[model samples]
Target: MWVADYLSLLITCQAMSQSDMEGVEQCFLDISVDQVLHYDGVPAVEPWATMYIDAIHDKRFGDAIWARYQIFGDVVDGLIDDGRLTVLESIEEDAVGYKKNAPEAFDEAVAFYKSVTNSADGHPEVIEIIMRIDKEDVSNRYFPEGG
Candidate 1:
């Protein structure tokens, strides 16, 4: 079921002729931050969050690291305000891990996230995770780019 949704995301992107995979951004926005966390299989399924950031051209994999960054500020706020995490926890503790594909993309996303929101000043925990590269413990899926 999850794989189908993941594939659907890809097919939707392809059908829309999104070469750079802009569909990821749109899809994440469509799915909503709350929905993303509701899925227990997100860690096992949403493995592409950063799985293929390096070879942006074609590497058999893609994820919405960019959009995640866009919405992470809110995610952080919600989690922290709810007392789920402390002000010292990192993104790695959020239970969601990107495949660490393109660390730079994560960086750029963090920059964008911070620029638009007060997340940086609101909570250090949010800042710690959103800005983290988190290349240490992440799964990298190698799905065929054109497959």
Candidate 2:
């Protein structure tokens, strides 16, 4: 089980850009080890979290990435629940399928992020972190090779 966890973490790190790795690292540092190991909803100390922290702190990764990993799901779910599917759809259009246009999609995403940040219960800090992410950081993850 440990090996499997490590391997998955390795794969995730390998796939991430240097900045994203740093963000992951910061997240680990900000969160306690106990939180990672025993969070109620999710095991925060899983492979992805561990690999990110190790890569940035131990491996000396880049520093451009913002810490957004922790709140990613919450942001997405909030958007969906709020019926802001246009934001998600725009991102998908840019990231994949027939309308794969990074600039436009990124612009829309940014706008949506800004809106979220300004609204009540927006979790400004989390939105701020996510706002720092750019199209290049996520495009490859969402879109298949040559897609």
Candidate 3:
């Protein structure tokens, strides 16, 4: 799912209360650190914007798997746009890092992400966004792995 789609869960929350924050913690599941960086300046959908800003600023979330998972989601989205993955989804806690089948694009995404994460000038990890048209299952697999 795209960041905008993932943020839908946050919009459903009534307010930025503790429970609300707790409820939408997983909403951060499928977005990128790069995307979250822009939320501060861009007008967002209510409590989601407030929540994301706070979440990204948290050192623990920013440095750990939470952020990685979020960015992975973006990477997967990017890969899909690039034609690497056929499909991706969040299938509970058991299946970490959603994937349909193995694809080389996953490696590329991970490599870049890890490279930037471990690099000195990486904090503001930025990723390219590709706009893709939805296609059927039959021919989708033949697509390339980048925009």
Judging by TM-score against the true structure, name the best candidate: 1
The better candidate by lDDT, 1 or 2, is: 2
Q: Could you tell me the TM-score of candidate 3?
A: 0.23
lDDT scores in order: 0.37, 0.39, 0.33
Error of 3 at 141 (Å): 20
Worst 10 residues of 2 by lDDT: 59-68
lDDT per residue as tens, model 3, 1-147 = 788866865754432344323222232233433344445333344344444445544422323332333332444433333443432322111122212232244344334343433322222322211001111122333333342
lDDT of 1 at 21: 30
Model 2, 12-35: lDDT tens digits are 556555443222222113343233
Per-model tally of clashing residue pairs: 4, 1, 1
Worst 10 residues of 1 by lDDT: 54-63
**Candidate 3 lDDT score at position 3:** 89
lDDT of 1 by residue, 1-147 (tens): 999999977764554333443322231122322234344333313332332232122322112332243333434553442455433332444322332554555555555545543322323444445555343444543333222
Q: Judging by lDDT against the true structure, name the best candidate.
A: 2
lDDT for model 3: 0.33
Worst 10 residues of 3 by lDDT: 127-136
